[model samples]
Target: MIIVTGATGALNGFTVEHLLQRIAPSDIGVSVRNPDRAQHLADQGVRVRQGSYDDPDALRHSFADAEQVLLVSSSDVTADVITQHRTAIDAAVEAGAQRILYTSALGTSFNSPYPPLAIHAATEQHLAESGVSWTALRNGFYGDLGDLLGPWQATGTIAKPADGPFSWIDRRDAGEAAAAILTNASSLDGPVNLTLPSPVTLTDFATHAAELSGHPVERIAVEDEEWIAGEVANGVPEAAARFTLTMFQATRSGHFAHPDPTLSRLLGRPPRTISDQLREQMVRTE
Candidate 1:
């Protein structure tokens, strides 16, 4: 049996839905923090079990009878993130899961300034020492480039501090590729970066947006402090604004710049691009 954790979340939920198309429902189980919110999955014939990274016993129970398990990294941004991931990995090992899959990030490093990178790095180390065969999907940054580029629907100006290239990707495509990996989990090993084949900078994206909208969208680069002040003036929370500002610094240092074809090879097609996503957004909001 194959078990998927965080199955109710947007990314993993889509992964489970796609997995259903490739595998039998009875062969799949969903381990979520709250089973009450997962009745819909159960109604679809998925075995729903309650589990949380905070509770190792629950994880053991949730992973019962599973040959392979997918460990979706925790969303917690605090120091507890690594501890939580370690707990889950230990539980998966204790539960006799022969193989494990993880949803890691593209620029994951032990020395990255991004807090999440540390969490991923630590989890990978623990997974390696656990003696369980594992695969890490180094997925790209999944954000609305249109929003970052211009908040384009409302503002025709792309405003931010100078940034570097990002191979922006669609989450749905990531989910589909992840399902494919799970289907053949045994053949793959170590880290596989699931990113676009092309990387685009914010300036290039703004140019494309202007051409698509037939409007003159301007790309404005401001000082980091000024950008934070502007975001705060627009009613963004101080902590959120600061965190977002640091992301640009990370970007400028070439964190999210690499592009890989692993995702396309898994899906048997090209992953959706920022332009494709923006065009769909425009059509939907029109």
Candidate 2:
């Protein structure tokens, strides 16, 4: 059986959906915090068990009879993420899983300006020393570029702190690729860069938004401190604002610029482009 954690989330929910298409639902089990939320999956012949990273006994029971366990990384910024990951990794090993797969981010490094990258790097290191087979799906950035761009359509300007090239990928594509990897019996161990084939900068994003919406858009770079202060004054938490600032710092340092063909190869087709996402965003707002 293959066990997947955080099955209710967008990324892993898509993973579970794709897995059902490729394998027997009986061969799949989901370890989620709320079994009630996964009742739909359970009705489809999947084993739904209540589990949390903080609960070792629960995680062990949830991970039982597992050939492989796909561990979704924690998203709680205020919590000790590394500790939570370690607990999950240890539980998977204790449950006698043959292999452990982790959802990590691309450009993960201890020296990164982004704190999340450092956390992922530490988790990868723990996985290497866990005395079990492991694979880290190093996924590219997947989020609304519109959040960073602000209301470019209405304001005619994409304003943010300085940023560099980023290879943003669709979350669904990354989730599908992960499902493919789980169902295959290939020896693809270690970190795999799952990213789009091209990179896009904020300026490029502005141009795409302009062309897609048929509206003029200008890319304006704000100083780091100024952007943070402005966001804080507008009710954004100080910590959250600073956290976003580090992403720009990392991007300018060339952390998120690299693009690889591994994701396209896995999916057997080219992944969706930034323009495609921007077009969808415009349609939704309209």
Candidate 1 residue pairs in clash (backbone atoms < 3 Å): none
Return the TM-score for each candidate structure: 0.94, 0.97
Leading candidate by TM-score: 2
Please write out the lDDT profile of model 2 over residues 1-286, one tens digit for every residue.
Answer: 9999999998999999999999999999999999999999999999999999999999999999998999999987678999999999999999999999999998999999998999999999999999999999999889776676898888999889999888788889988999999998794799999988987888998888888878888999999999989999999999999989999899999998898899999899999888888888888888
Highest-scoring model, lDDT: 2
lDDT of 1 by residue, 122-170 (tens): 8888888889898888888886554476576578888888888777888
Model 1: residues >4 Å from true position, as ranges?
144-147
